[model samples]
Target: MRACTFVRASKEVVDVADVAALVKADLERARDTNVTFSRHAMRVVPVETTCFAGVDEIKEACKPLIEKHFKSGREQTFAIAFERRSNNTLHRTEVIEAIAGMIEQPPNKVNLGDPDLTIMVEIVKGVACLSVVQDYEKLCKYNLRMVAMTKEDREHAKATANGNAPAPGTKKNDEEKPAEAAD
Candidate 1:
C-alpha cells in the first residue's frame, strides 16, 4: 500500500477512520455544521513495471500534468519535488533537472524559497501519482520550535569549537548584531 507519513509532535500513526469520526464529531458539536469527507492521499500501482523505467518515463508521465499546473488556469512560478518510495534507477537530482527541462516553459521562473505552485510527484511501488498542489504550505512548513541560524551561528554550535564566542542566551549575545555578511 502507498502511504505518506506525517510528523506530529505526538508522532501518532493516525487512523483515517478515527480522524474522520473525530472531525465529524467536532464539526457537529458546533450545532449547525457540515462535515466534508476529505481525501488526503492517492495510491497507485503499475501493472507492468514495479518501478519507473527511468527518469525519462518520469518526465513524460509528469509532462501532461505539468500542463494543467503551468499550461492552464493561472500562471505562477513553480518548483518540483519527488518522493521515492521504492528503489529506482533514477537519481533524485537528475530526476528534478530532467523533469524541469521537460516542463513546457523552459525559461519559466523557479522559486525555491517561495513558489506559487508546487508540482509534487509521489512514486510508490511502480505507479506514479503526479499532482499540482496549490497548497504548498502543507507540503513544506517550518517547525516553530526551531530557529533558522546563519553560518557563523552554526559554526559556534559545534562542540569541538572553542573561542571567545559569545555564549548563547547571554544578554550580550542578544544585543550584538548578527556578524557582518559572510565574505
Candidate 2:
C-alpha cells in the first residue's frame, strides 16, 4: 500500500461526486497543459465511505449508498469493481453478487464495458472502501499517467486513430513477410 493513499474527502468535500469532479477537472487541466508532473501517482481512486472489512460490513455500508444512487424506477447502468489487497476473507464473486442483488433489476442493469455508475469496492487490510462513481472507465480507470497525455503521446494517438501509423510497439499493418521455408 506504499503507493496508495486513502483520504476521507467527504469530511471536507460535500459529496463523493464532488471529489470525483475535482479529480476529473485536475486531470483535464493536466492533459490540457501537457504536464507530466505526476510521476509516481499511478491511480487516485476516491471512495465515498469505509467500513470494517467483512462481507456483512460491506453490504451494510453499500445499502444506503446503493439506495441513494440506484433509486427505484431510476434507469441506470452499473458495474461492481472489487479490488482486495492483503485480504482473503472476502470472495470476489460473492461481494459482486451481494451488491448487484441490492440494486433494482429491471430499472438498473449491469454493464461492465460502459456503466453509468460504478460501485467501487476496495478491501485493504481491515477496511472496505465503497464509492458510487461516474465516468469510472472513461478516465482511464482514474490513472494519472494514462489521462495526462503528452504531446508525443497525443500525436501517436492521432496517427493511430487515422491508421497512418502503428501504435508504439505494434508492427506495420500493411506489411507482410513471406514465411521462411522449414529446414
Per-prediction backbone clash count: 0, 0
Best by lDDT: 2
Clashing pairs in 1: none
In angstroms, give how far residue 181 of model 2 lies from its true place.
21
Each candidate structure's TM-score, on Cα atoms with residue i matched to residue i, is: 0.47, 0.76
Residue-level lDDT of model 1, residues 83-107, one tens digit each, is 7677565467887888778655644
- Candidate 2 Cα errors over 4 Å, as ranges: 10-12, 15-17, 31-37, 150-173, 176-183
TM-score of 1: 0.47
TM-score, structure 2 vs. true: 0.76
Best by TM-score: 2
Query: Which residue runs does candidate 1 get wrong by more than 4 Å?
Result: 1-53, 73-75, 104-107, 138-183
